[model samples]
Target: MTLVAYAGNLNNRANVWVSLLAEERRRRAVRAVAEQDHAAVWELVEAFMAFRSQSGVLTSVHTLRSYRTGVRQFLEYAAEHAVNVLRPGRDDAQRYINALVAGGKKVLTVRSRVAAAVTLYKALRWAEATEANPFEETFAPQDRMHALEKVPPYQERVVRRVLAAAQERIAQAQPDELDRATAVHTLLVVLAHGGLRIDEALNLEWKDIRLEDDELRLVVRSGKGRKSREVPLSRSAVEALRAYRALPRTRKHPPRKVFPFASRSSAMYHVRPLFDEHGVTDWRGFHALRKYMGSRLYENLEDFAAVAEVLGHANVNTTKAYVRVGNERARKVLRDW
Candidate 1:
């Protein structure tokens, strides 16, 4: 489907008088709607955009742009399929969703577009502009849950095996290569124990780590949404890091950062293979470490807010998606019952 055609066409209207600087930034949404072919749907889009602006719902310029782009695409799909935007049926909505998924759009993208469609309809409905709400019924009960989008947490056994491999590799390295081995070992431990995103781990400087007499912590400087939080470090991870820092390679030229690795790709070069060799499936990248941390923290602390805070998630529901209950725990709960 030509997703950009509707926006592109709308953006090129001869009568519209937008500044070149504004048009150059790909401002597809805020343009004046001069298209009379689909005036009915266009009117609804205008009303919805106005409503979003007035209700303070569109917090960011990005969100407003997304809603505009997505709604226009939906209208284009509706016009082509001979479906009424104001009174759409279940089949009409499903077809649009299916087309988006089949056309290789990410699930989240399709879902977000559908949500934009829903917001438009709701605004129209509230204004007595439409009688039906198709987008609401189009998504299944299960589809509304973001669980499928979540990264599957790493199995405890798999995590243990990966750590074991790192230790084994450290032991097998020659004396002259001990520093590299120590760095790799420490890297894996920091990820597994601290539950840091690979980028967060890569950004770690010596100053971020606090190896206090009674406690250890790593201050996450750059978290999701640029939020920062302090995460407790495991004893094993702290010790591994200590060993890595003491090595001749590290001591001779102390790193500006805690981990010797420079980039996420470079760190992954040393880290991913450990799991790859063990035939790990569903490789969720370093984010899985954060998921594992979320799950473990929830299990131990029984606090969603606390887990959300540590992971630097603004929403607790997002944290819920990150944490996964283990199969063993599920089976045990059932068996005891």
Candidate 2:
């Protein structure tokens, strides 16, 4: 199959996967072109992988996988242009980024691609080649971030209804599938109530649970920047987890992750399909949970600082976006009003 044609599905975007795969093979020659340092790229990635493994801080496998795609694309583009990758001067990096933007890539795409490039550059210490790391001179944030186009708040009912249907399917499945269903349900609760990204939800472990003053708390070990943060478990979340723990577990091993069967992949692997199966059209993925959590939390709390703590955000500015509480359904709101 042609490279793009081979990557056939939403699950992995086959074209990107195939391209990254080819890049992995080509990386050796890209680095140290004069010396044919074929393994230079691999060595760089492996160094990050090893650091992540040993330091227990630098790498989450989910993030590492993304770097694979981003850096591979950079190397692939460099190879096509006949640029000696291992020795790409700083201007070359600038051109590579500009070329991507010039080729009709959206701002988010451009930013993500640049971020990916930055990761590889940092991984191999490529940034030091520039007196100031030309990438550091990014004078402004990408348009995607500054321009806020949230899914309309009215859509919460759409998402919640869809989730409710997904719950019914879970409740009716056979015993074997029921375990998976229960796992799915538990994950849903984490998304719905705990406001966790799917990977954060999947990587959750029993040991992270701390009950203090009768309130349940969750400590997420793998987060952006590997910053460990705490999330308060709502009563529904607490009860769902308790019931989930009561359910039969697959791993005989103690203190492993919550969703043992889940792997390090995109969060959509869990959330997106539910919409397809239930026919909830145009639905986004797990980040909706953050929105749901943020909107709901604002009803009870006013300060973004508290919301930031609740959502595990490093920056209060990020938490501000989440705290905008839209008016709820008229019936729900007018129960006494």
Candidate 3:
């Protein structure tokens, strides 16, 4: 919302072409179509973007950019199919799906594209079969989906290597000697053991941690879906955190957010290098560390329900995917027989 407001406010007015800037901005919000069709598609796309914005999903400018790309493609599809009509041919729907696959996109990536199209479909749904309801026909079949590229399961050995490697990296680093290293490693444990999203991990405050207890649990104030939950702490995690807290805090510093960086980007700059040095592939993303962490917990505990609780997932199903056990593990047990 802040970014949206800032982008909205950019103008020279008497000295600059404010209206032209606004026109260009609006055009960016939708994908291109024929000159005659662009207006309608843009109008619909803007309304959808505005709705997501109001709901807070479109909070960041980069997020708006992603939405722009998705919605633009949707507009083209809608226009090509003449979605204004009550019934679009089934062929129209398949062609669009084929086009996405033809671009060499994975099923999951294409799923995101279809999801955006579905969102538009729902937002625009009336007494209409426009675009032959493309979403329904494409994703309803399990085999077709199975044939689409799926993320390969993270093998047990790889998952263990990742976690053990993280610990080794932390052991090798002298936190007191390196504040940036210390901060990044400490936060990684929070994501791994505390079952926190990267954003929530980054957003932690001093009050969120309960260190005095024999166990450590973090109170995540804002999480996905804007819901909150408490994540359990491990013994190693408690000790590391206690050590981190004993470090300096400025009088001018904010009460919350224990690891507030100069900015989110600066934190990433520090974290990325550490991941590169440590041989962990997650420097590019906090969620990858998150994925392995969940896997480690699930393998050890063999309890998806508990993992879900720690991860603050409303549904255990989501947690299961994060730390999913594979058929290979099941085969090992069967082989023992």
On the 0 to 100 scale, the lDDT of residue 105 in model 1 is 82
Report RMSD for candidate 3: 7.5
**Candidate 3 local lDDT, 278-330, one digit each (tens):** 56563436566566667778778888888887777889877766664676598
Worst 10 residues of 2 by lDDT: 9-18
lDDT (Cα, tens digit) per residue for candidate 1, span 1-337:
6443232332332113222243331223222222323344444454445444443422333455677677788878876788866567768888888888888887778878887777767645544545677765575223455562555778788888888988998899998767777777787788777878777777788888888767688899876556789998888987887777676653433477777676777777888888888878567787777787778888898889998887778899888787756665799899988
CA RMSD for every model?
9.7, 8.8, 7.5
lDDT of each candidate versus the true structure: 0.69, 0.63, 0.59
lDDT-based ranking? 1, 2, 3
Collision count for each candidate, in order: 0, 4, 3
**lDDT (10s digit) by residue, model 2, range 45-90:** 5444444334333455555566567777877787788765556665
The numbered model that scores best in TM-score is 2
For model 3 the TM-score comes to 0.63
Q: By TM-score, is 1 or 3 better?
A: 3
TM-score of 2: 0.72
For model 1, the superposed segments whose C-alpha errors exceed 4 Å read 1-100, 109-150, 175-177, 250-254, 326-330
Identify the candidate with maximal lDDT: 1
